[model samples]
Target: MKRKSNIKVIRIPIPTPTLLPHTTTNSYLIGNEEESILVDAGYDTEDTRKLLEWEINKHGLARPKRIVLTHAHQDHAPGVRMLIHWMPTILCHEKEEEQVLSAISPWEEITLIEDEDSIKVDGEEIIVMHTPGHTLGHVSLYIPSEQILIVGDNIVAEGTTWIGAPDGDMKDYLQTLQRLRNLKIEKIGPGHGKWVHQPHEHIDFVIQRRLHREQQLLTLLEKHQQITSKELTEIIYQDRIHPSVFPVAQKTIEAHLDKLLKEDLIQYDESKSSYVSPHF
Candidate 1:
C-alpha cells in the first residue's frame, strides 16, 4: 500500500450495545491513499452494511480490501455475511476462526491472522496485537504512523468490558491491559462507545477500576471467610449495576476470584462451593 497522502480514520457509529446504556459501537473505516479497511462490522443486519456503504460512498473512500474483526463476539462480527457480499476478504485472528465460522457458516474465505502480523492498507501498515482475555482471540490493530489503536473489546470507553469466565479471563484481561498501556497510542477507537482521545489516561482508569474492584472483593472475602461468587457480587456490585445484569456481573467477579486463587491469595473450597481468602 502506497500513501498517496495522509491516511484518514472515519468512525462509523452503529448503535448496538443493547445491554448497556451505550448508544453505539464505533465501527471504523480506515484508509490512506489507495485502499481502505473496515474494522468490526457488527451491526448483524443488512441495514448495518447499508450504513457502512453509505459512509464509504459519502466519503468517497475506496472499496475496502477486507473486513477485519477484533474478536468473535456477536456485536463485533455479525455483519460478516453482508460484508462478504461485496467480495472483500474477512480477516480475524486464527484463534477466533471457529467462533466466527459458527456465526456465519459455510463461508470459508476468511484470512486468518496472528499476533505481530502486519496488515497493509494502500501503503500504510497496521500492526496486529493479540490482546485476548475479553475472548480467546481478541485483537487490536495499531497504526504506527498515526499512533491510533483500534482496541476491540479489550477495553471500552463507556462501561467496563465484561470478563466472564469460560471465554473471558481476568488474568489475561489484566495482562492485556498492562501490555497495551505500554503502547504509543495517541487515539483509541474502541469496539463500543465513542473514541478515547487520551489513550493512556483511559487505559489507566480502566486498569485502576478493575484492580480496585478486585481489592474490594478481597476485603469482602477476608471478612466473610468463604462466600459464593454470587454473594460477593451482591456485596461489591449491588446497586452499581442493574439486577438483570447481575448474572454477567457474577461471572466477572468470578474471574476476579479465579485470578486471586491463581495468585494464592484465595482458594475455592469444594465442599462449601465458595471461595475463601488466604487468611482462612
Candidate 2:
C-alpha cells in the first residue's frame, strides 16, 4: 500500500544485493496531485520489478508518467522496460545516451536529456544537471521549487562513493561535488543511502573528504617514486581497501594518475608498471 507523506512520496527500499551488507536501494514513488513517477529502479531482478508493481498498484497511481534513471548502471536501470510497460516517458542525460542506449534492452526506447534541459512533469520542472565522474554520463535531477535533489551514486550518505574501477574518473567526480554545492539543496535521494535531510552539510563532507584523499594519494606517489597504478593504490588505500572494492579502487587510482600526468605532476615509464610523481 502507498505510505503517504504530506507531499505524496512513498519510498520503497530495494535490496542492492551481494554477499555482504550495504545501504538498500531507495527507489521513490513521487506522486503529484494525481499521477506519479519513479526515481531509480533497484537491481535488474524479477523480485525488484514485482515489488515495484505492488507499490504502484497500492498507490492507485496512474501508469507512471516517466522512469527517470539517475545513471545507467544496471543496478539502477534493469526495471526500465518493465516499468515502462505501464507507459512512462524514459529520460536520461544526453551524455549518458551512449551508456543507456548501449544497455540493449528488448524494448528500444529512451530520450536523451540535453544540457540545461528541464522536463516538465505535471508543471514541476526537473532540471537535469550533467555531472560526470562516477561515470561519463552520470547526472542528477534537481527540483528547485522543492529544494530537492535526486542524486544517483554521486554521494551516498552512508558510505563513500567510488571512482570505481573501469571508467570512473576521480577528477570529474571532484568537479561534480563542487557543482552540487551550488544547488543549496535541502533534501536528497541518494541512489543507495538513507534519505539525506542535511544536504549542504553532506555535500561539504564528501568534497572535503575527497580532497583530503586526493592529497594523500599525491603524497604517497611522491614518496614511493615508481609504482604501478595498482601498487600505488595498495600503498594509498592500505587496509582500508576491501576486497570487494579493490578492483574499483585500482581503476580510480589510475584515473588520478592519468590526470596528474596530464598536468605534468607524474610520469609513467612504459617499460615498467610504475609511475613517478615530480615531487618524488
lDDT of each: 0.84, 0.73
Output the lDDT of residue 141, model 1: 95
| lDDT score for residue 197 of model 2 | 94
Residue 149 CA displacement from its true place in model 2, Å: 0.6
Give the runs in model 1 whose Cα sits over 4 Å from its true position.
Answer: 1-5
TM-scores for all candidates? 0.94, 0.88
Tens-digit lDDT track of model 2 for 78-119? 667556556566678777776776552754567777657886
Candidate 2, superposed: residue stretches over 4 Å from native: 1-7, 18-23, 164-166
Query: Which digits, one per residue and each the tens of the lDDT, describe model 1 over residues 69-138?
Result: 8887777787777777777788888888899888766566789989999988877888999988888988
Task: Give the top-scoring candidate (TM-score).
Answer: 1
Distance (Å) between predicted and true CA of 25, model 1?
1.9
